[model samples]
Target chain A: MTTTTTTATAPPTRPVVSRPQERPFGLIRHSLALGRRSLIKTLRTPEQLLDVTLQPIIFTLVYVYLLGGAVSGSTQDYVQFLLPAILVQTVLFGGMATGVNLNTDIGKGVFDRFRSLPIGRSAPLIGSVLGDLIRYVVATVSLLTTGFVLGFRVQTGFLSALLACVLTIVFAFCLSWIFVLVGMLVREPGGVQGIAFLVLFPLTFGTSMITPKETLPGWLQTWVEVNPVSHAMEASRALMVGGSAGTHIAWSLGFSVLVLAVFAPLAVRAYRRRT
Target chain B: MTFAFEAEGLVKRFGKTTALDGIDLAGRQGSVLGVLGPNGAGKTTAVRILATLLRPDAGRATVGGLDVVRQAGKVRRLIGLTGQYASVDEDLTGTENLVLIGQLLDLRRTDARARAKELLNDFGLAEAADRPAKTYSGGMRRRLDLAASLVGRPDVIYLDEPTTGLDPVKRDDVWTIIRSLVGDGVTVLLTTQYLEEADALADDISVIDHGKVIANGSPAELKRVVGGQTVLARPADPARLDDAAAVLAAVAGRPADSPTRGVVAVPVSGDAAFTEIVRRLADAGIAVTELSLRLPSLDEVFFTLTGRHTTEEAA
Candidate 1:
């Protein structure tokens, strides 16, 4: 068979097309661009906002009014105690959205488009985690605003409160890598949701996220005290309210780093193979 | 001659099923090499491998002379791919999808925007440029997907059954766009289970079956391999069918196969055979409602090579 390149060699029929030079930091740049796309998706589909915007409000109300007295003896006293836990729970839930959205994106072949592009291999996952951080920020703010309205105050001052929010969001971003791995491994979006809920339910509720670890039964207390959610709750509590912050902060940061070190590479590997 | 796309002895397996078994293909620069296959025949598998979307188990392939495995990043820069499913973001507007791809391709922000608008207009999607792709009809979604792939204007394109779910008119639109891309000297590797699509688009064709290439040639060359064409005549009077069949058989020096009522089809070697059959029918005093010479279609070529017909679903 005659190759068309023969003609080009002879007479050069077509103009020479110059290719775009690869950017030095194309991975980070592409990730930011994709992250912006994901954020716009959240904006256009406002129902995705419900978890951050509405979940905290309703959950805060339920904990303060219905279960507040039973847990902390009074609604006024419980708001300060319950607010940080609620924020942790909210960010945790927000973090799981990463896995679900990633799974759905894979199912719908969006990543196929990304995979074919000359972009970074891990850009989609990194971009997704970054975009979902917006959800975490919204949840943190909503929880704090609702808590303050319900008589909660940060005893440790404004900087501490800001630190607490940043710490929690960072921890949530790290925790999303675990769910990102789950999302990449799961067969379907629904399956990701199911597995995420299964893994998260016991970790969040059994910890000091709502009721104190001291009140739990002896055997369950062991698991609750060691749970990463409890450590995050304690870190945020230490920063937002007055407490010994160093140990809890260390543990939360340590857990975040460990989870990232483990799951981030695994998720990236799975993504490369699966896509 | 430098091949824009080339694959040799490519083998891929998913569990126990070999999706591709030692398949080989080559497409010259600025030409379309159609990989036509039935479902489970590894058309998509081959395209995916060449597109740098999958790894071949045992073969080496190259695009623009860059190794697909080792020089994948360079290969990606030189090729654009459109899969069977529309890969544009459903949540984003058509403009957003194209712009995002442009940005990912490392275009300047303003340049990307300009290119997106130009593509939207070229694809006849300018009116719906700001609307989310979810709202697009199947054809529009496909057009947007194709438009997204062109944002980089790569040297080679891999289209994996791009018109699978599109209506006839939409498929034709995609065909036109593909032709224009080739007209601009873009080499294309098109995979399709549809015989007619390959016939319409490909300069050269490879027929794959059960993960192997059963045949490879230009469309006319492949049709010749199946056999010669046939001359058919339908008698005006049903009672004269035998007479027309006898005349066709006498001139063509073969048995006339009557597949339908009042119609006789005789295999003819060339135009001379056609002329002799017409003269003989006229001498036999047979009045026919229709008379024509029909070349064997890709369908017949496939049937001759493989015992089974192509279907939408894979085995």
Candidate 2:
């Protein structure tokens, strides 16, 4: 019995091995890794990066050259007037890419994979939203560079111009959460795009992103004055043009806080449901 | 020994459709429990609950003594789950996928990289570690998925149809990996529609149909439940098939099936009946070409219990 046992043990012990010990990371670490992966994907796909860059440049040129005379009466005046509007409109439109990417990820079953892992529940949602900041900054810089080339001046000085640009991007970053919520709620990519367009088109185009609300019809003017996008655009315009801190600035800041409060939780809730 | 995983009266309903109806299961540590079922039989639902991915409408489940509902985080720490399809990010490389999972499970950056390298080498993916998962073959992707699940070194793993789409050779490769995992004392709950897969891997088999576990036991025990033994006989000569059939009929009380082509099958109850049939055939001077006594297979058992063959069911 002893001899037989020794022979059996020798063969079995040669093949049998121990399992490795596991060490789990915290939520913050996981969220950073997810964010890094998203950024890497953005770097690898330069062709897809053109949307945010081109839209800001083309729209700034078109409004500055073609519609500048009709709207603001002078090219320089239109450049000053339309630059801030272009900043707000371009950044807001840039936020839509987040929804589209999220929709694509969900359609491809990427989110389902995240569900099975032991990672933080909020990591994917938060990381994806944060990753789009790269695009927002890219669009903002391209629009600013184009406006500068066209002889547009920032009378509020370099520091204030930088702050205004930051505010516009930050506001756009906040607005992306609303689209992230929509993306999480809708599973299909096309459906997400349609929902995003329906929500964004009127909000940006109908508001004061381009012209002052005082120049519109009485009923149309009333709606535009209260619109959150209008408030954001007007506040941003004031900051760039060396205007006073008035109701538009107060309303824009208030609207930013309100949008974040309402949509952040909704987006997180939708993300939980998705998993 | 205490069970590695247990579920008691697990009931889950999606809208008005009852997916699982009071199912209970207890699996021993370091053993493979194969769940055999047709489609819509709640096999996936049971795995989901055990993996802490779904909540039961009513019931309790525990992994390593941690409640799946009340202590989901702890249960998740102890368990790893691989679903029907490969669930890794296709945009990431194989190494990136495994390392990401390791990092999520809390490994240090260096440690995660080391673990990822080891897993890639172990799964024979070292050469393709840097290639994006979208470029991998089906077998490679499946292996990477399995490697991803093992990144946490889970005490118990839930594999729901791990070999659903693999060819015969690749399926056998996965079976080898599962055996190694069990050797390391990891308890596994495997669900699959292929009866042969269950026969190959399961130490204990549970047959589920229509949201209920109709049968559960060791493979040999369940096969015994079907009936006694069957004696199959085939004639050497095609023309003399009926003669052999008549001889078998006279010996066994139960009528033999008609000689199809040149073979006749007769079901026998016991060794005595089999011996009598052999004696009668010898005495008739008819040389039997083939004679064998065998118990029913799991396929037949499924048919006998469910009143339908596995192939006929749209699983």
Candidate 3:
């Protein structure tokens, strides 16, 4: 009897504190916090890491051993050539996880909760984009480690090789916004995955990944020349191996800036309008 | 007095179907305003508009004197939303979900953690705080969802059918939580398909149907809107039904209508009249096989208002 009375009389705990005043730079802060959530969620589900970690290593082994002799005279030369394209290719596909995860997220009610919060509208989108930087880093490190193990050497210094990794990561980060847009409009995560395949396969394979551009048909060579993915691959290759990298670096940076400018706004707009 | 939140002449359409048709709603500060309706009666569309999750095609809505569309960010500071689906992140732990919401509200990391702990303890989730929300029972996930909404101490909160699909015991827990939130003087906009829930928790109830509010009043007033209750009496013999109707009419202060040949029912003002019917039927020597006073269910109310059976509402 006394227990019922005691329980009824006890006050409910509401530790919620109000900070009605708007904070400056809230975009950066909120994005960072949401990004932390993505990181934690990813860590808890280690299988999600298979795309970044496992894919790169497997692709490197297959290409360097299977196609290495056919593409180049020796497995040694092919491994060096394949490593740069493989890193860029892996991270570019790694960007798909961002969209697929987001598509799955929006299908649930979590995005509705985020939308109702006081954070900046684009914070969740940008935060997931930032949080996925881990995937790119993992792919780069895994691919490079596998490359070194197979006797593939970077002729350029360590700093230039590091710059090449940075370039590919930045390009992938910017490229992810397009997938983010797809995630927002598409009804299903499977649809996002489908579009990712439709977009990525041609873009990655159409590049001079396995063979030299000069050996391909004239029309194909022209595409490899203009393709942004090819620019990123060529930029990384030139940076890791000794070459005049200024033009390729400029084209890669320019493509990253262009994609970010066009797709970031579109993705954010789609998110706000999705409901 | 200015409302804690208000929506006026709000219209929203998805393709050719209008989800909300020029509806208006308002809730007083520190009180519960129940938006009672069946499924797809525009209750959720209305809540989403007020929560600033969905923009209305027409009309202006405000929360704490700020426009929902123009000043959405400011309105967000004053409001929290809980939907029928648990909105807490399934991948995150209970503590992590609440803490993330806290951090989004700009609380320092330490403060966010402390607040998350407090909420988890209060919601009876402290024991499972470290576990991912996916591992939580349905009730535990709902608690964490509610906890996530409360992390910022919003002045107004929108609960969109919060207890839908819950067991009775879990529902009672949610009701208790809602009552305590009201006790803390937070304004609430609670939508539910259950009329009893609205009557029990709402200071004012707005009865809506097909995207329009058909009635609005305190629970008692809304109850009376559909003629309150009925003094239903069934005759032991079909031949004696006329006498039963007369007895019911005399006691209920209105002419009784025979819904079926075997029974006569007349809407009564209160339960006190039910006792009068019992007394008068005995005086008249009328044999009633069944006699009772019954309150109107939501289906009955909708039937009375629109002359439409709520067959789909039940679905």
Candidate 4:
């Protein structure tokens, strides 16, 4: 047994090591590490893949077979028009998951853990968005492959088709910041889900995703014309099927940049304010 | 001597309600400062501010001579915080959670992995290291969370009611772990509703109520605030309690209180008081079943100081 010593002496305070000072670009390194964490989480729970994987395939196949003859005279013709719209819908839904996941993390005290760490303040927010890029890639490939199997050919060159896929993924990544902002302010995953969809559902459906804007009523067409989703879909459609895509691509990119500028800082600020 | 951490006139408000009203805290390096408070006493708020999780509305706080708000990143490097809830990622395995924290603290991948393994083994969680934290028992998850905080070997650790929901066995284990950390010379700021916990572990205790420090001292000092030592006895015969009480009163020089059947206790002042009571009881032919001279319980001290009952026992 140890002897009891009550000397009234204060405990010794050892010098703390100040090594491993935060290096330059430490934010990027920390974000990448957290991104890897999100990726591993996705891998473990493969069900998180269902929204990006199964939704695209189902939407492409069902739309082409069920509404093809009625809307565009042939399933082949309809697949050409519907594939990009389906991909856009898939990515939009994919973006909502970012908010839901972030809300869940905040509610679970995971964000508190991150905040107490020495990492950059913005790392967790940026990392989750970066990791979600994989979901977009998964959706894009599944939609394209299913359309190709259904006899939908990309008239544009492979380079243009690749650009179309990249455009949708980038747009979705930008939109995720908006959801991240919502996630930070909201307290529950279910609440985030409801609010995000309430904001997104009208935008996706009111646009020309399921039908041509010209075929819609005047009031609806007016909204569809200004809808960013329509611009993104038009950009993807023009790139995949041969057309002059410069204006649509510029509009899509410009809109995404504007959203990113407005939402990124707001999301990060909200995150910092939370405990 | 420089404090490991200190907060002066800290104030935080949520809407119209002030969560912290000029709360002040100071802790010496390598010493334990136990923050004892009932629910909604702003203990967590104070810890959060010191941990750099939230900015105070007014007043200044520092960790290791760095400002909490202006130098939050540096302060973060100096402190490890285990919040009131287990903050480990439920979706990640125990090993993964620790490694993630290690890497976030700027450790290389291999180093993070090695540290993660070492922490898991040290916390007796090697068997469940690969299992998702969601599957862990409450105690296991708390261990993993604490392990994550220690991965960076922070100079100061903030344990915010870490043992709140734990069973006694698990709580003892946590206490042992905390003692070892203190032995390694890490400064600790622990917040608990359990006064006994503070008495058992703290070098000094601060009792907070309504966002203000109501009492601050060592356990013995706080006990003295309530009263002096008490002599208690239970006679072998219920009828002999009166004789025992009279003997105790004569020796203690104060009237004894019979709190329950066959039990009499009275406040006593000196060491000779115990011997005097035993001699007097024997002379009076009072056979005692139980006898002891003990200080007042922390519960009594808390009630005497705050004039309110504790919501939970100091287990």
Q: Over the stretch B1-315, how does candidate 1's per-residue lDDT look in tens digits?
A: 868989999999999999999999999999999988766788888888998999999989999887999988888888888988888899999999988998899987777888899889889999999999999999999889888888887888889899988889999999999998888778999998776788789999999988899999997787666556778899999998888888888877767766567778776667898898888778878878899987644444465577444542368
lDDT of each: 0.85, 0.78, 0.86, 0.84
Higher DockQ: candidate 1 or 4? 1
Instruction: Point out the worst 10-residue segment of candidate 4 chain A by lDDT.
Output: A1-10
**Candidate 2 has what TM-score?**
0.83
Return the interface RMSD of the candidates, in order shown, one decimal each. 3.5, 5.0, 4.2, 4.5
lDDT, residue B82, candidate 3: 93
- Every model's TM-score: 0.88, 0.83, 0.89, 0.86
DockQ winner between 1 and 3, please give it: 1
Residue-level lDDT of model 2, residues A80-150, one tens digit each, is 88887678889889899898898788655345556666666778877787777888888888888898888
Q: Write the per-residue lDDT of candidate 4 for residues A1-275, one digit (tens) a residue.
A: 12122212343553232223455678899999889888888888989988888888887777788889988999888888888777888888888999998887666667778988988888998999888777888888777788889998888889988889889889888988989999999988888888998889887888888778888999999998888888899998898887777888888899999999999999999987766
- The better candidate by lDDT, 1 or 4, is 1
Please, what are the lDDT tens digits per residue for candidate 2 over residues B277-303? 788778877787887776544445566
lDDT, residue A68, model 3: 86
List ranges where model 1 is wrong by over 4 Å: A1-18, B227-297, B311-314
Which candidate's DockQ is highest? 1
Candidates arranged by lDDT, highest first? 3, 1, 4, 2
Using Cα atoms, each model's DockQ against the true complex is 0.45, 0.27, 0.40, 0.37
* Candidates sorted on TM-score, descending: 3, 1, 4, 2
